[model samples]
Target chain A: DQQVKQNSPSLSVQEGRISILNCDYTNSMFDYFLWYKKYPAEGPTFLISISSIKDKNEDGRFTVFLNKSAKHLSLHIVPSQPGDSAVYFCAASARGAGKSTFGDGTTLTVKP
Target chain B: DTAVSQTPKYLVTQMGNDKSIKCEQNLGHDTMYWYKQDSKKFLKIMFSYNNKELIINETVPNRFSPKSPDKAHLNLHINSLELGDSAVYFCASSQPDRDGGYTFGSGTRLTVV
Candidate 1:
């Protein structure tokens, strides 16, 4: 079973526009959520994360919003750039689980 | 220096051959994990080790074995590989607390023909 789900396989947005990626999870035991960006032939890098206690976390142009009640989370990149084009993966882990569950990933293309 | 590194970035071998993938982490983290990204782009956990002790072992085939000689090294050995064994395997490390996200290696793509 896929505990984490990124329903959108791909997304496209114009440069300098807003890019939003969505993810949902079926496991309520997950308490921490994270986002990772991956490029071709490279491993995923950490982007942003939010705990179940908080609703939002922001870093520079990237922001993550977590809606615990809906079991949904989203990543928002303001003024998207061409360099932002990559696969974004949503991951979640229960406290002390020692491992995280990852989504299938959503490929984002920011057109310049 | 790379935080997590895996050897043999690409491997192409015939079916029934045995191969080994080596992984090392310089981050000094206590926990390390192996993740396999399949054709569908799903990253699934294969095994996990904490301080050279096995912690999590998913429903993987018995042919696949993970050996952790030390906290910094975790290696995967596959015996009699099948065509379905082809995938990109990633090694990652993180602190036991897990407050921060994991650091992953570039990944090793294995193709069994």
Candidate 2:
């Protein structure tokens, strides 16, 4: 079963605009949600994360919003730049799980 | 310097052949893992080791085996390779108790013909 899901396979946005990526999860036991960005041939790099206790977390240009009631989370990038074009993957983990389950991933293209 | 590195970036082999992928991490983390990314781009955990001890072993096939000689290295070996086994394998490491994200290697593309 897919515990985490990214409905949008791809997204395109103009540079200097805002880009939003959404993710959903079926497991309510998950308390931690994370987002990772991946280039064409490189492994995924961690971007930002939010704990279940917090509704939102911001890191400079990136922000993550979590809704425990809806079992959903979103990653938002403001003033998106061309360098931000990459695949974004959403993952979740529960306490003592020892590992995180990843979504199928969403490709984001920030046009110049 | 690269934190996590895996060898044999691309491996193309015939069916029934045995192969191995080596991984090493310089971050000095106590936990290491092996994840497989299928054609659908779903990253699934295969095995996890902490301080050279097997911690988590997902329901992977018996043909696949993971070995960790130390805390910083983990290797995967496959016997009787099949076309269905073709995928990109990634190695990652993390501090077992820390909340930070895991560091992943570039990944190895294994193609079984």
lDDT of candidate 2 over A1-112, digit per residue (tens):
9999999999999999999999999998999999999998889999998999999999999999999999999999998999999999999999898999999999999999
Error (Å) of candidate 1 at residue A3 is 0.9
Residue by residue across B12-67, what tens digits does model 1's lDDT show? 99999999999999989999999999999999999999999999999999999999
* CA lDDT for candidate 2: 0.95
> What is candidate 1's lDDT per residue for A26-53, written digit by digit as tens?
9999999999999999999989889999
Docking class of 1: high
Local error of candidate 2 at residue A10 (angstroms): 0.3
Q: What are the per-residue Cα lDDT tens digits for candidate 2 across B80-102? A: 99999999999999997637788
Q: Which ten residues in a row have the lowest lDDT in candidate 1 chain A?
A: A44-53
Clashing pairs in 1: none
For each candidate, the alpha-carbon lDDT, in order, equals 0.96, 0.95
Worst 10 residues of 2 chain A by lDDT: A40-49
Query: What DockQ does each listed candidate score?
Result: 0.87, 0.84
